[model samples]
Target chain A: MSGRVDIIGLGPGAEDLRCPRAAGALAQATDLVGYVPYLERVAEDSGQRIHGSDNREEIQRARLALDLAIQGRRVAVVSSGDGGVFGMAAAVFEAMEQGDPRWRALEVAVHPGVSAVLAAAARLGAPFGNDFCVLSLSDNLKPWGVILNRLEAAACAGFAMAFYNPISKARPWQLGEALARLRRHLPGSVPVIFARAVSRPEEHVEITTLADARPEQADMRTLVMVGNAETRLIPRPGGEPWVYTPRRVGMNA
Target chain B: MSGRVDIIGLGPGAEDLRCPRAAGALAQATDLVGYVPYLERVAEDSGQRIHGSDNREEIQRARLALDLAIQGRRVAVVSSGDGGVFGMAAAVFEAMEQGDPRWRALEVAVHPGVSAVLAAAARLGAPFGNDFCVLSLSDNLKPWGVILNRLEAAACAGFAMAFYNPISKARPWQLGEALARLRRHLPGSVPVIFARAVSRPEEHVEITTLADARPEQADMRTLVMVGNAETRLIPRPGGEPWVYTPRRVGMNA
Candidate 1:
């Protein structure tokens, strides 16, 4: 039988949120490759060869998956959220472009999943109801200045924003700095959502504004969303106020 | 029993791409409401009262769903992709905020799905591997000037972009104008993907350069993706070349 590599997303921490196609891919795999925590999310009795590695070793993992697939192994590379969005799909393609020439001939397919931003936005009312931009606040892959420039551009353009990798052990100051920069472009009353461990048992969502948001509230597991000027906060009877950006932008806006 | 409304996404166009949570919501719904095409995608013999309307009647549909839920009906309002992203979720919240006061008390939930951009990117080897922005080309709700301003800002910020509603019978010239504007900031060699009805039987993905992309190549169902300067194209043996944007950006970029 010919080998193939299927890159699949497990969704954001919930079994029900994952696509059935991704689940089917897992069942058909001879090898499973991903970060340790993501690998642990799979069923233990899948009977596939499990290769779990550190989070920082994406390139190495991609190469290993490709090498295994070339050897006629049905490999499945997994990521926590949609593999196409800041996940393993890009790394696998990057590896194919830079690694062994035969790797390009291997059959590779990426299956979509419920992305982190979409899951976080669903928990909150619909902060991404209108046009929006998604950025990673982690400056490890890109420069700090680039992130700031993109933040100012998206904010000034009046687009709501979703941020991944907002805070980590090594980069705690960036989220605060990003919020400070956003305050310069957006109103103090504009809502900011801090969604941590969304869709999991430990899920927590907090709503604040640009003027009062703190970086300490978020960790690597958190996804942050900031609304545009037209975003509204509707007070409900007994729960958190629903937040959403209107679909229509008035002429004056 | 108290009433509730569940706004769920049907995903791009495939049954397998829809989340199990969304499927669960649909199964539990007593009334299904959405645009005619989206509502038709559900099982016809599900025994639920189906309320289908024209595509332009979003606010009316949302209000109807709210009214039904207020009468103690289990309502499911469906959108094509993730309901939070330019879908029915925002319209539902808007109706609640502006309509009946009791609507605020009704339990409402938004379930995430495979969004159009994510599904399109997955089909084309992760074109949105890095920071990206999603914009709608239709100017029906927002002014054309605002859309242009956003296009310029996102392009200058070096973001990969996904455009929804690129071409409709009412708005044909806007996409051409938008592409011309993008050409001013992005190099002609930048890859542009026109993905029509992604994940469906009629799915067609065309990869072209900014200089070669035409507005006529898209339709109401197409999702357009424009890569940043760093996006690359890798040639394989007998099929379309793989396209992706690298996760890392050099300091010079």
Candidate 2:
């Protein structure tokens, strides 16, 4: 118990996906704290009890991670995907403001890895080639009204969007609600790329229209990217698909 | 050579920066084609003379790469950043569209990489937590009018902006012009983060304001990320400066 708190990124799940920097930090950690699913992503023998918590207990888990850091533990907070992207990095900072004398001495570092949004966008080529937003449809953290307001604003701005935590087993109807709102501004034929368990063993990317997207097709592992009106899907040789956002400023068409 | 031309993403600069799948593609490449600056980034010996091109010869060089691919070279038209973000991948497609019929028959895939934009944004504590756009100020192929239109749109929409190729030796005042235009809509004190040579030998980041940023402070190697109305500069305990874009929706405070 003589090291700073290191918030490590587990990349997109696979061990090979771990950034060298994230791996190095995890190797040096004595304690790992996160949700059970995220904690399971780290393979190292943590030598400390896994601090698992339900989603509502994130505040408590964050506080415990910081307290251990204050006690000079080589604490590792495991966040799947990049630590900063809808992950645990901000929660750690949220709990850091607690006025503890020992906490003041703790060093905190956020090692970034690939975000699933970017990974999903990549699989669908240029789905995010222009203005974009990453929004969570879950109402657990914020009021649904606020989500609707931001969704409307984002849609009016005409940015390609990636939805995170879009559909869960209990929240089947929220995705439909969000997509219904998207239909108000976005065209019905806007290409939506839904990638499940990206960069993991059971990874698959499905392409469909926004109007045709179904919650039955998605799960917690799915990352959905919806293209802007300018995005084009063109067929290529041998069943390989190609999608592109038209060059906005420079190309001679 | 009965192979195709593929724009492989080597990820960021480091071998570890590469995606597992992208790394697999690079290992299978028989020919590597890119500018001298980017060609040097490829680690493996593909046994093909690297297609070196001057800065002004990008169009011709891409056309040449397409020609070689038409002759059935398993050519990997390499680019430093994510191929779609101001990289040569777009140019290769342009060249292909205007090339010989045989060239159009070959398959082309644009594998995404961890762009300098993503890398720099991560270092800055996720200034892109909200809506954002990445645009280049380099007027080589784009008209100033078009560039200004997008800048105006982004600024008016209050979008966080990441600028690539903001300025070079010959284009020293481009940033000043961009700043002047951007400042007209944004507040004079909006925070600007200049990440120079990110993840490279001379890597460093500097924080400045709209009215205070000097043109000489940046060159083409730099990435300028200007935060939006909600971004805050927090003096963290680690003394590594941090900027955060508020999640905009959930302000329980």
Candidate 3:
């Protein structure tokens, strides 16, 4: 059998939200590899040999998948959101570039999926309506200074921003620092959304303003989105607020 | 019968790339409103009434969908990519906010689809594997100054960037100007991807570097991606090159 690797996204927490193309990759795979939580979401009846690893073991997991593919096994490397964004796709490529040159000859495909950014944005209306930037707040991969700089730049540019891995047990203050940096350049009334476990039963969405946005509102599972200067909110009589950023820039802007 | 509006994305192009949820929305839609090209892609035998409009008529198209929804018809406002990202979802919300107060009462749901950004990135091997910013180079909605400022900010901040609507017949020089701005902040060898009509039969993806990137490479249908400083490329013996931004940033970055 020809060896191949499919980097697939599970898409937030819902099965239906997963792209049909990604589902096809999983169906054809002989081995599955991802974080325990993501791998658990796949059906046991698929009969694919599964290898579940920790979230921090991305490179190792990628290596395992690459090795399996090199051995002529159909391997599917899974991620919770779009694999290309801070997910397995990068790790697999990194491994291929740094590890075995032979791995480059193996067939590889990255199947796009509905990302957490899209999933959260869909659940909370169209807050990401216009131009936006996405950043990961964890300093483990980069530095605190780099994250803060990007946050400030995005805020100053009046771009809607989505933050991933905003808060974790080891790095709790980064989210606060990010919000504070944005507050320096933006007004207090700018809208902020904290979407946790999106599309899942335990999903929670918190919509507030910059002045009211707290670090406690976000956790590792939370995807935080801060709207641009012109983001607007429409209050409903008996439901959650609807929020969106207008597509057009203001006259002065 | 109560009317509703489903703002759905058709994905980049392919039928299978379209989200199943979005397909369901189209199937349930009694009235469809979108640009002519997108509207033409929907199946004709679905029995849905189609309202095809001009490319620049987003607001008017949104208004028509809202009016149909208010008149107790299921309306689907279709966009080629995820509607939340520079698509019809914002226009629908903007129209609802400005046109009729009753529109606030109408049921509106935004169904997320695989965006062109994701689709293009997947085809090109995770060039967006790290944090990135997305901007529209078209200055029609926003001023040229704003687009230039964003281009500078994104390039300076070391974010991988995606440019939507990079070039049009009338505004041909913007892409070149945008590339020139990036050339200042990014190295000469930084990878740039020009992905056109992704997932379509005529789709083409050109992988080049900042030094060789040209304005004429892109058109209206193309999505351009510029990798961050740390992005890497893996060359195959007999295939197209693979590109990805490493998950970890440099010490200085």
Candidate 4:
């Protein structure tokens, strides 16, 4: 009896943002595996065996989920945002490729969700209305120089950017350095948004300009977005301004 | 008695993929506004007054929704994917910025949804599991030279890319030209994905190499994804291979 493994995204910490397909997969799951916080988002009454692991143990967690599925268990691996974006979906595929050969026989599927970048962009109007790039600033898996190089390339290309894992205790200085480098390629007036825990109760979104943006404004929970050269802001009477990038780009621009 | 406008995403072509928050907004809407095809995605029984227009009439649609909302009608403007990403949200903000001053007083919100890129990536394993860029190949809104320049920058930066509006009747040659240019910077072995109408009944996903990809393989309904150098395919016995970009990038890479 072969079972299936479903990798699902919980969608930016909001229960309402979770799609029906993902919820259905969660309800039918015989076992749940994920980081402890994401696993806690699941209802406690489902009575599924939960395998919670540290945030850094993605490979181990993926292997465990695959092993369970190989043993005829319906397993679901969860991520906070879209699992396809810097999440467990890749790790599971990696494990299936390099680990137990039986893992390949078990059915595996990925369910998409509203990624943190989309969620944050929604809250900020439409800063990503045009072409954009999504990058993770965490250098734990890659070299820091590679991150800076990509940042410069995207910035010079005039693409809006969404950054994940922007700042943490281990890498507090990287964000500042990134911003410093961006200032050379982009105008100081370009809009930058720091959105934290979007769609959750503690959600806070701050819109600022590149000239005034500080590294301390963002934390590990934050998703940062920097606009392209054409990004604009529409002022409201008494509330924060709405930010958006116009759909059209001039021939010379 | 002022009513608000909610721009919501329908999430590709699947009802099951639509989030509860968007559904709730649809249920409460007194009026709906969208392009004709997306409006058809709504249940016929919703009984809301829908203002469906041509696909190119985004600004006019945004103005109409704002006008209805300003007249104390709860309006919901729908898009097939995330409203913030090349959808009605930017158009609405643009209209509000330049059309009517009363639009500034009316409450406007953008609800996030699973975008076409994310949905396509999910259906094909995790091709966007690492840093990636999203671009539109349509030159209707931007200059063709700008598109090619951005493509080159992203390719040189080693980003996996997702392309929207890859091919249409008016611009049949752009995709082929874009691929030819990419051949200059990227290896011919890079995997390219053509996912057409993902999550719908007639969904078809094709995986090919950069060397073998043809312009005829895609249409307006297709979302194209090209992997970075490190993207790998793991073959299954009787099924198509799983495509994923590992989370790690080496120092030299």
Candidate 5:
């Protein structure tokens, strides 16, 4: 807690695509801090890896990492996409604020990464055409009423949407409920694009009608994109557009 | 072109963040293609850079890039963020289809990058919380009516929105029109975020009410986020929390 916390952004999944800064940070670190899955993503484990786990364990792991760093160990806490953006950096800052004085005094810096939202958006041409807001479906901390209000607002606004933590182990039906609500406001033919495991293994994208998408299509790693009416599934007849979205909105209508 | 055509991505703005594969693709390119500013942002220039002076020139540059690649030269057409999101990759494809059949059979691979929309979204939390849409307010190629219709539909649906290419040198008042339209359906206090020059030298972020944001606050490089009513800006004494609109339809909200 005595030393600074350097939260490194390894960018997206591929090592060939990893930032040199993040790689250097890890190589120089005496300890690493991050969720277990993220650690598993990085195979070249040289430093003392901080075994952080599930949602509640981040604070404890961050404290331990800060404590180790306070003992003069170079520490690097990892996040899959960007260090910021609903990632560990937010929790790290929270811990530093609520924890010991030594931790508070430490200098912290966040390196930006290629967030999956941006990655998924790029896969689809101009998915975010104008004004759009992103909200997580996980109710673990947020209330559903608040989530529904925002979803309604977003649907009403017709912004290209990117959904994260959409379908989870326990929260299987949240995304479905969201779709049903959106259907009430938006034309059912809106192109809803699902980019599964973007930038990693099992990377796949599906352009389907908002009503046609099944919950099984999405998993923890999947990044779902529900396109606006203008976005169309450009079916390539013989060879499908690597990306798909119906060209016309409300074709189902 | 005897060599393969690699459409590389320059992740955001920093050099260290450049995907190693993207960098490698650029290094092997005999000719590089992109808009002027994008080319300048890339770290190293190993090949002849084909900078497009105008939008129409994008096709010309793509043609040259394809021609160079077809002539047995390694060609890498560059895009500032991701090559696919309003970048050269699409133009390159378009050019290939239009080119003489003798030259159309060459291999082309598009490498992805961190797109600006996602970077902006990550900075603002999940702006795509529910259903949303993105639009470029620039009237260069698209008519104002087209943009207006999308905006109208989006407003009625209550989608969070992200506005790119909002203000330019000539069309200074376009954003004002958008703001005015949004105000009709949205509360004046709705969060309107401005992400200026993201990941660039003069990068800055601000969250203001829809009506409070002055036209002078934006530029060509700025990304404007007008959140749905559900999108609330948590104001810190001097700083604003990057807004995240939680969906309120289910228990999680």
Candidate 6:
């Protein structure tokens, strides 16, 4: 029988944020395959064969994991956040759909970890406590039109919005354009959070209003959140501000 | 100095799925408080006082945890799934926003967990591998019209959607109306997944087309995912079907 394949999430850059299931899979794996940064997360002395590949080589890395599993090796494919969220899980399935027929017969399980969306929300209180939408602003994979449509829809619906891959060196204006679209529907006072390097030592969270939010404030490492109309900021005398979205809509209070 | 209050998630009903950060908080907690089902997840011999309250008592529970923390007891506020998403974190913030001024001076931290959205996505092979929206169909807090508007907006945006609190005995027809609304914007053939009790022993995942899906198929325990227009199903010879939303949108295949 072929050995099992476990696709695991390392969570969003924190050791303790990693779930036990993912950690156990890493400890038990005969081989580990992932992007370079995620691969660095595992201990070097674990005695497991590690294959670190370039970023965006998900399909190739997935195929490598599958081949190793077919040879009766316990293989773990690692992704930074939850493997299923624009991560290795979809790439593995895509490879399996188009790769060797035997790959389909192999055992596969995906162990989810804390996603960056959750990590950012946790750091900034409960900005995602109500209805919300998550979008990737980079147009590298999807058309700009598609991203714009989703942004407009989310903005019009007044859903709290989380943007992953908000800004990068290659696509700097996407965030500005997205915000411009949002500003068309949402009030200028809507709060926006720029949660950078969440849970890591260099973590920084900035709370700003939509009108004051600048695109340059976000980078590839940052996760940006735009509050719904109902979201609020509660000030503290001695600490950072807390942001939260109340559960109700259209209630007279 | 008053003790700290940590609002932590237990993840989606699995011990291993729980994040280590939350586990650490639980280990140090002088008191653990949450909804009855989640509070029961903790081991009885853990030496911490457990306060289990009836559902809908989130504010009361938050107050209790705060009161405990103010008394110099390290308190952990537990929630199933990520606490920031429709969970205890918001309630705690609400309590702190409206409660004692001394509560604002207490230390607080939110440990992210493996949410049901991620857990269900993992079990069903990455239905949320792209842009998506998460909405609660329960109209007890929000107006039904708000839910319908957001559902229509999400559907119109062509986003894969995860619906929490999809259906309950008190409001069974909401899911049907929701599905009917999605059918109007999306193709009848769009895929929908019902992930019930994900990551637990009673876990079950059902993949069905939107046209064939019925409201009765889901319950309060289910996390329902309605895939984007591009979501696909790959049939396997030896296992259940794999569902995935391709990473790209508006791509020529």
Candidate No. with top DockQ:
1
Tens digits of per-residue lDDT for model 3, A149-209 = 8888888988999999999999988888888888899999999999999989999999999
* lDDT values, one for every candidate: 0.93, 0.71, 0.90, 0.92, 0.67, 0.89
Q: What is the lDDT of residue A154 in candidate 6?
A: 92
Q: Runs in model 5 with CA error above 4 Å? A: A55-74, A93-105, A120-135, A145-157, A181-193, A202-211, A233-240, A244-253, B1-5, B43-51, B55-74, B89-106, B117-135, B141-162, B177-212, B224-253
Q: Give me candidate 3's TM-score against the actual structure.
A: 0.98
The alpha-carbon lDDT assigned to residue B201 of candidate 5 equals: 77
lDDT of 2 at B30: 68
Candidate that beats the other on TM-score, 2 or 6, i.e. the better one: 6
lDDT of 2 at B87: 72
Supply the global lDDT for candidate 6.
0.89
Clash totals in order? 0, 0, 0, 0, 69, 0
* Candidate 3 residue lDDT tens string, B1-253: 4999999989999877888889988989999999999988985856888889999888999999999998999999999989998889999988988888788888999999999999999999988888898888888889888998988898888889999999998898989998998888889999999999999999998999999999889989999999988888899889999999988887642
lDDT of 5 by residue, B1-253 (tens): 3766787778767676577878888777766667777776663664454544554376788788877776787777787766765566656655655565544456666766766665676555555444455666776656677667667766655667778777887898899988888888888888888888676777898778887987778888888877777764433344345465543433421
Candidate 4: segments with Cα more than 4 A from true spot: A251-253, B251-253
- lDDT per residue for candidate 4 within A1-253, as digits (tens), equals 6689999999998889999999999889999999998898895855799899998899999999999998899999999899999889999998898999888878998999999999999999999999999999999999999899999999998899999999999998999999999999999999999999999999998999999999999999999999998899999999999999998888542
Per-residue C-alpha lDDT of model 4 across residues B109-227, encoded as one tens digit per residue:
89899999999999999999899999999999999999999999999998999999999998999999999999999999999999999999999999999999999999988999999
True contacts kept of each: 0.93, 0.18, 0.81, 0.93, 0.21, 0.87
* lDDT order of candidates, top first: 1, 4, 3, 6, 2, 5
What TM value does chain B of candidate 6 have? 0.97
TM-score of each candidate's B chain against the true B chain = 0.98, 0.93, 0.97, 0.97, 0.89, 0.97
lDDT (Cα, tens digit) per residue for candidate 2, span B72-98 = 677777777576666766566556555
TM-score of chain A of each: 0.97, 0.92, 0.97, 0.97, 0.87, 0.96
Q: What is candidate 1's DockQ?
A: 0.89
Of candidate 6 chain A, the 10-residue stretch with the lowest lDDT total is: A37-46
